[model samples]
Target: MLMKTIFKLLAVALLFASCDDVEPTIYNGNIGQNDTFLSFSRSVYLLPVVQNQTGEVKVVFNSSTVSDVDRVYNIEVGFPEASPANPETFTVPASVTIPAGEYQGSFTIPGVDNGLVDEVVKRFTLTVTNLSDNEYMDNDTTTINIYEVCPLQADFLGTYTIQVASEPLGISAFEAGEVTLVEGDSQYERVFNATVYPGYGGNQQVTLAFACNFLNLGQSIDTNVTCDVEDDTKSLVHAPAELADRSAYDTNDDSYFELTFIEDSQSDCGSPANTVLTFTKVE
Candidate 1:
């Protein structure tokens, strides 16, 4: 009876141990009985540029091989026949080489110059072929998008009614004012000038410097704004320096400004009061 009981315990332990060794299977359709497979590192790449730039595309193997010598691979780049920026606009390498015992290789596309003034997005495609070894290329291709950075200045330069308020402090019903954007010192800069009247019986003239880009509307006027609230009295408001957070947008032929201003010092009204300003372009 004792020997039978010991055998049963041992069998149960072996069963639990076998179950613990089982691993979840991750299905990979690209991997087959062969150990070598080539594929692009990414499917899409966005290249934003104003002048000339270089972009790289990487080719990786599923598994590294112990090669004594370098292996070469041929790649083909295809561009839209109707693309205005065609072969003359860009150049791609004909092939890439992987060093011995390496699992990856890269190809460079050079001389990507945006000479055209027209703001248009261009794209090209790449495929891997002609493997030096008896390896297979995965059924995948990569697409490269080239975007020209054209500043949208004309779209945002106009007069608009702006309303400034601080709801938490019960400040509202302010007088409407106009804001305008003039050409700045550079092609990417804009001078933001506005005069706002607050319900708290004070006039604030705001002059901010802004940066313009193709990705979105215009960004903050400047890093900070110094306002002379009263005679011989000046206050500073910390503004966002980044483009995305502190920018204005245009929709349906109307320009809009949604920004927050944080005071640098305490005032009689309040300390650290957040002021939100919203503006709409007037026809």
Candidate 2:
């Protein structure tokens, strides 16, 4: 009797161990003929190289399976680039077929510049499938290497009167108000107001000329509005007429511009950041 009881106890212990090693094949209503996961493998594509400045990207993944489960096998992938996540989940048709051989799922991805790494090279992949049993699969993977590009600046060289509008112009900027082609004639009907820098600048006169032809792309604007740095006595003449007729100039990229009494500070007459001042039409 003692021997029989020991044998029975041993048998129960072995059965429990086997149960522990085995994955639960059935849940409340999952893993049935309508809920089995298909065993599969797939390939995904990440950007060969990423582009910067925009900081956005898109990718795709293709997956397949060998023995499809019951209902249908939902699919998903993982990406190291975005966030750490669990296996992706999807719902399949109740009578979906794994084609008796293979299953496929292709995903399209979209992203934005998150300031993580601009124009940088990073990598990520897909996490494959999620099982209803909480047990999931991760296999599909891809990589993307990003490269950042800089934007081109603008040129702002000419004679002009500076105006303040909606937003502040980053560099020493100027805006055109009206054009008097010559004396006693005007083009636009805008009101003449106080100059931007009241006391800092000279009093409003009959005509003002701005020579900003030297301001071009890639040039830095002079911060201090001075007649002449060395000496105020050697200050160049201020032209207001041209300043009023300043043309609309902008840089391909967000760049700087200059507005100096003397046209000695501009660089790259045509490139972004530099412009030449030509205050003609001044009376």
Candidate 3:
């Protein structure tokens, strides 16, 4: 009986020793030590309707957590003022998923070419919400603007009849002929380039360049002149300092170009200290 009692006591001591050798499991609510927040890849994006019909909005995690399961996120759309585009204009997904091992996810926003032009610029805002896990934080909301490619107040791309309404140079009244206003080069938009006769009896032809702001009908006509007389090409005039008076006006489906420039000191052409070149769009 004494030996049996000793054996039982030794067994209990071995059980307590085994329990002390094993480490206790500590439960931590956070998967990683660092904090993670969801953010949009870009705050603003231009939706190209011609080249790329769709725009992508990516949801990225600033810092990724050691997540065992896929993280899901919900997006909400809001219109600050009057909505320019309806809900039908965009194809927004209900939710986006960040894969188990991935830190980024994206959804596509499609642009519809409905031939509708909005007088005012339209925008829609997107925000991230309803995160699958409460451990992550939500960052800033993104705004997407949708508008048609309407540049000018009126169609100003065509031929125009350029004439010097008043020239102090005392040169004969010349028929400048039809000066074709072509679209500007790739570098410029809403700008036109043309070679017109600004001299007497169609004698001197000069390169004309002009541009108009699409948002506002503000116009700027270039007064720099390249005169090529008798196969001798030289820059006769340079752009003036003050162009506040120069402007363009569109009336009755006809655009008028009213330009005035001060000639530089290097100019050999006398008189007409302030050159005024006018243009009437040809029908």
Better of 1 and 3 by TM-score: 1
Candidate 2 structure lDDT: 0.27
For model 3, the stretches where C-alpha displacement exceeds 4 angstroms are 1-30, 51-63, 117-120, 132-140, 150-283
lDDT of each: 0.43, 0.27, 0.43
Model 3 lDDT per residue over 68-178, tens place:
567777778877686546665566677777677555566667666455423233567777777545344334466665543322445555777767665443431234456
TM-scores of the models, in the given order? 0.39, 0.22, 0.38
Indicate the TM-score of model 3: 0.38
What lDDT score goes with residue 54 in model 3? 29
Q: Candidate 2 regions off by >4 Å?
A: 1-44, 48-102, 129-283
Show the lowest summed lDDT stretch of 10 residues, model 2. 1-10
Q: Which lDDT tens digits does candidate 1 get at residues 1-283?
A: 1111110101122211111111112233223333455555544444444444333223332223435466676668877664434555556677777667565566556435546422354677777777545454444356655544433434555676767655433434235567675543233334454432242233332433322232222221111222332322332333332333343443223366555554332342334445566767677
Tens digit of lDDT per residue, candidate 2, span 5-91?
110101122211121011222223322333332222212222211222232232322122233343244433334735332221111
Model 3 C-alpha RMSD vs. true structure (Å) is 29.4
